[model samples]
Target: MLELLLIACLASPVGMVIEEPPKHEAAKVEHPKPEKKRPSVAVPEEPPTAKEKAAPVPKSTPKPKPAPPAIDTKRLAEAEARAKRLTSENAKLQEALARKELPTGGEIRNPAEALAELREGNRRFVEGHRIRSLLASQDPDLRQTLTKGQAPFAVIVTCSDSRLMDNYIFDQELGRLFTIREAGNCPDTQGVASVEYAVEHLGSKVVVVLGHTACGAIKAVAEANGKPLPGNLWSFQAAMSGLLETTHEDPNETAAEHLRHLERNNAVRQAQVVLDRSEIVRHLVSIGKVKVLPAVYDLATGQVLFLELPKPAKAGESAHH
Candidate 1:
């Protein structure tokens, strides 16, 4: 029985006795390990070529030019024509002046024609007739023509007396007469040269030595009566005295009559002196190119009494006419 109980106890759940593990002897577990990594490096670039380094260039623009001005052909032609016309007019005027045409239209060609002109003019003067030539001298055109040159018809050697009007008495204008005046109408050296120039160069036709009835010079010399005159008048007195000595005196003639005779004789004597002193005058007179005469002007009567008249040159003589 005991054995049977023992067997049952061992087989029963609670009746068995088990052994336990010690506290100090526990269980151990293992884990996996971490991995290590390496660092990264940078790379360098290559240089550029010549063709990739150059840049492109830009182009420039040009400007336009201006046009020329227009010409006026019609105006230029008109101006040229006007200039030509003015030049032609000036030439014509110069040619007319060269021909010696008087503006009054009277022409003097020769000495004879000049003498005839003077005679006709004197006649007209005495008759109080007015001719166109004398009246036209006041015209400006005629005066301008006279300025070009002078052609006197006659030359008169007369006294310086205020009463003697050569222009009025002869009916002459500014250029018609060449007159030489002195106290006694005497031709000294200078006066002779002037007469010669007129005859030789100016073509004077006639020369007259005119004395008056009551000439103061003749009276003064007569009163001197062989005595020397005062100052430079002695030269004139000597000349008059020489002329008087040669003059014939009537014994019964009154003093006034003698003086008048001397006056007339002095006129004739001075006229002769002109002929003797100037060879040019003598030659002209001989050839009938010019005539020299002696005359006395009666102050009271206004009449000219010619003491001597010039005869015409002989035939075959060298007369210019």
Candidate 2:
């Protein structure tokens, strides 16, 4: 019976074991029941196990940015080729012009050297150390040489003032300077055409637009003050169209001083007019084959003050706007 009772107790879900109480306790005490062992079953692990999840992963780096575009090589090559072609064409054109003109002997070819020659000649004139003009002995030789073909190094556009003689002022001999005289030194279309002929055909290296201190035409135009002059003289006012407007009379200056200022401005304006009117002269100047300068001749001192040239047009620009 005791054996059967033990078997029944083991079979019970609550497997408890009873124990006698200690002498200090009055009631009986029951021990805790033991848990039954569960059957073992396989459990599928998730993609990342605890070990895999705990491990650190490397971070992904970003990509770098691209560089900027370069200039087109094809366009650069075309531009260089075009420049070389133009230069060759210009050289050929100059050769043709020189052959057509039949330049005389002892004429200056370089533009800078020609300008220096003029300056030196003027220095001699001012100092009264005249050499070329005093060589009366060379007159026959000079006349004969000029008969071959004239190649004046400098073209002088001056007033018809009786007192002023370009050959004497610059101390240049015959065939050295090509002079074009007008009442006011203001060039008309014909005057500009003459300049073109001189530069293009005669191979003149420098163009001098010379004005004097006491100019009758300038004085007349200034006195006219927009009022038209009588007869053909009115052409003078038209030729120097904007002289008075361009130059203002200073309150501190006398009438003579103001007239002198107008003369200077007129000289510069006429020089620019030549460039404006003649594309041939402009081209020669742009190529550095020729130079156009404005000069003021002092009647009192017989000195010529060459003014600065006007600002040049930009490349591909025909004239200043």
Candidate 3:
């Protein structure tokens, strides 16, 4: 007990307390800093850099080119040659044909050839078929080519019947032939001039006297009953007067037979008249330059029947009807 009393007395004298000392007398301590709040850890963001956002660019396309021009020359060379051949042959064929002694049809070989072409074309037309090749042909250009000159293959002298379209009937392409259409197949100054041009300059090889069935001029002559044709129709009437006279029938003859006879004779008689008048045609014949043929055309069947192409007057024989 005495030892405990002695220690307590010494410690109390030093003034140390069990309770904490006052704020002023306590030793100071520095405060610890708070830990910073971090971002959510599953996906973190990097700061944006400059190079990742370069400006965008556009794409380019290419252009197209042009087209070329057209041409048509396949048949033209043959066509040119045929034209020349016909012109040459025509002058020879004419001298070998005449009125009564008519040359053999076969003598003018190309007459049959041309007729074959016409027949084939007409058949195609009737059947509603056309050569597609003809569509490809730029024949309007051919006209421009022909203005420099034309040498058509043959000549057609036909009745001026409105229904007769020789071009269509013959299926002749442009510049392939020379054509004359007249009432009663009459040849006037203008008509003769046309013939002269075809034979002399154009080198037309053959002249065909193409007469059609059921002609209006022939009908007019038949209706007259031996009476003179009307005054205004003199030129037309005179041309067929011989046809009316030669086929004149007794009043008792039926009208049908009268008209038929008139039609046929008109063709034959006109063929004779053509031979009589055109010396260019004659020279073309007598010299074997061209051939003249009498052809009767049928409206119903579109057929052409050649009745005669008399042989040339033998070189020494005086020839007449």
Candidate 4:
């Protein structure tokens, strides 16, 4: 029993020590992902050969480009409206200026307006043009126009003395005044007719009988027509005796005084002749249609002693008229 026990113990130990074989593993597939690589080569930037360069494109007539869209109707309408408004506004402004009653250097349309303008200008000249700057330019257009026609604004009937020049006395422009120069500024029949034309046709408003100092014409009348005044003036001496006789009687008066008295008297006489001789001028004067001013222009003072008259007032009121 002991021997059997020993054998059984050995056998049981041997059986307990026995182990199952390990499972076999799959075969290693060490393909290394086939190394998954292609041959690495550098590429050239150029074509493979110069002869293989791209061929030039053939020249062609290009298709017409698409047109831009038509302009908007609203934009066109707005532009037209703006243009019309501007044009209407311009016309309105022109109309307003036309109707305005201002002396815009236009023609003096009436006798009364002409007189008023002369008086107004004289007033401004006597005072000063301190009001505002004048906008009038010396028109070059006048230069071209005056070359074509004679438009004398005034007619000066004055003495034929060296001391009296019409442009100097009145500060007038060339062709601005028509002058009929004579001794004593007296009206013969010729002078009478000339004055009528100046007033009636040339639109001359005034017949300026401008007289001056140291008159030879009056001296011939004063010295009793004895010394023989120069140049076809003796006939006038007979006509002017009444005026000259007044000067001679004043013995107290100086030679200068004699001349001044003569100057004034001659202007007065001529003014009378204008009314007596020219019926048209006389009618024009009487109706307040035109003015006839008898003026004695002083050589020393450059001032005019004027008589505004319906002229030919008698010698009795010579100082007043």
Candidate 5:
């Protein structure tokens, strides 16, 4: 019975030891995840047109320049011509007034005629009708004429006062009047030599010792009253002191009258002094070759008053005998 049971157990797999199946842990399966898709953008299919590609550019315009101002050429030319014509007419008028006959040689050749001419010029000046031509010693033609030789008709020894302009006072131009001036119209040796030159060399016939009112030199001498004057002024005072002493003062005369008397006396004395000191002038006067006159200029009236007029000699007396 046991053997039969073992055979049955072995055949029935119950009696043998059962073995456990192998336990292998299942391996985890790996798989790739699906990729995320981006959304698609739509693209335009058209190209750019020719008008859009070729754009026009704007042009700038330039500003115009301003016009120049007009000139009155015609009017300007007419004015210039008128001025020229007026100048010509004025020059002609001057020539007509100065026209005079000139005589041949000698000291003054004709003293009376020269005196008359001077008187006429003075009259013109007094009347305020001075001829322009007589004043134009600067004219080229007149200057040319004078350059030939100077023949002044008068020798004026007058005070060196600015108010006493020899040319304007006499209305005489260049080459017409020879003048000598000192502070008091007093002549020294040098002055005498100049006068001699004018008479002996220049043939001047008339010598006028001219004085004026309010002579400063005369006043100074009077005020000094024989006291010594300062510097070179002493010479002038000394020369004038003798005249002051010789001048007779009137008791009833006003101060102005006294001053006027002194002025007149001073002029007369100066004229005598010229005669006394200059042998040449004395000889000329004695021979009737020249004349010396004493005159006073009035500052207020622009008039010259003759204190004494020298008598004109006979026609033949003018020539040196």
Candidate 6:
């Protein structure tokens, strides 16, 4: 009976279902569904407030520009024309000056040439080659020609000594030198006026204050020693007021030497006096239109020594000294 029971247990019952245990099936691999995209819609901005709309927008300020300079065409043209004319005249003058030739009729227009002519004439006179002036005096037509008009080139302020003849000393003919004579060669007011006339009207280019060696007038003044001279000659002391102070007598030098010094100083002083008293002379000298020089003439040698001129005074200076 036990054997039959075992065999029946081993045998499968007919129409019995045998179901397998539920497998894990990889957790069913659950894939998530794709997310759907929604259509986009733009949101409108908020409208400006009434106060902001009514307010004005600030603008940048532009810088102001300067105006252009005005041009005067007529004045510009006149200036250009004047410059050209002056340039042309200057070129012509330079050409004339370079040649060193005297113009027609042996006339000198400028101061340098006038001074040179005087020097050459003096040289001729000293060297005994003075021939032109001799013939000039003899010429009949020369005097008549001079009568028409005179254009003296030099004005001579010289002593009235009998031996000191400026025409013979410089070998200049008539109308060539306008001469003024005083006892001491010191120019007074009238003498200065004569110089003004010569320079301004006659166009004389050189004014020479000429002194000389062995001058009697200088000796008289020196010997007088501030004492009033006898007769009308006392005016000479007044004219030569500061001469003694300017030229102190040297103990080592002879009395004659001191007189010579006084003579030369007087010449220089007179030249300065002319410049101080006469504005016309000062202006011409300053502009180079004329020259005022002091010269010493040797009575024995007949030679002229031109002294160095003093420097011009500054403007507004009342006196030259």
Top candidate on lDDT is 2
Worst 10 residues of 2 by lDDT: 6-15
Candidate 5 lDDT, 154-236, residue by residue in tens: 88899999989876777765677889999989888888788899889988888888999988888888878888889888998
Considering lDDT, which of the candidate structures 1 and 4 is the better prediction for this target?
Answer: 1
Rank order (by lDDT, best first):
2, 6, 5, 1, 3, 4
- Candidate 1 residue pairs in backbone clash: none
Each model's C-alpha lDDT? Answer: 0.63, 0.72, 0.57, 0.55, 0.65, 0.72
The per-prediction CA RMSD against the true structure, in angstroms, equals: 58.5, 41.0, 42.3, 44.1, 50.2, 47.8
- Expressed as tens digits, the lDDT of each residue in 1-321 for candidate 6 is 222122222211211111321133222222333332332335235334554455575665654544544656665564445334333433443354356432112447698898898898788689765533644323454455456567789999999999898888887767788999998998889999999999999889999999999888888888899999999888888888888888867799987788888888888888888888899999998899999999999999999998866665666353224
Better of 2 and 3 by TM-score: 2
C-alpha lDDT of residue 104 in model 5: 16
- TM-score preference between candidates 1 and 4, better one: 1
- Candidate 4 CA-lDDT value: 0.55
How far is 239's C-alpha from truth in model 2 (Å)?
A: 0.7
Worst 10 residues of 6 by lDDT: 9-18
For candidate 3, lDDT tens digit of each residue in 1-321?
222222222222112212342343332222333333444445347323332233242444533333332323444443434334433433333343323222212232454465555566566444443221132222444345445555665778888888787666665556666889887676666776787787778666677777878877778766775677777666666666556656657688777766766766676666666667777777777676766776777787776766674454664231223
Indicate whether candidate 4 or candidate 5 has the larger lDDT.
5
Error of 4 at 302 (Å): 1.7
Model 4: residue 225 alpha-carbon error in angstroms: 4.8
Worst 10 residues of 1 by lDDT: 21-30
Which parts of model 3 are misplaced by more than 4 Å? 1-137, 248-254, 309-321
Decoy 3 TM-score against native = 0.57
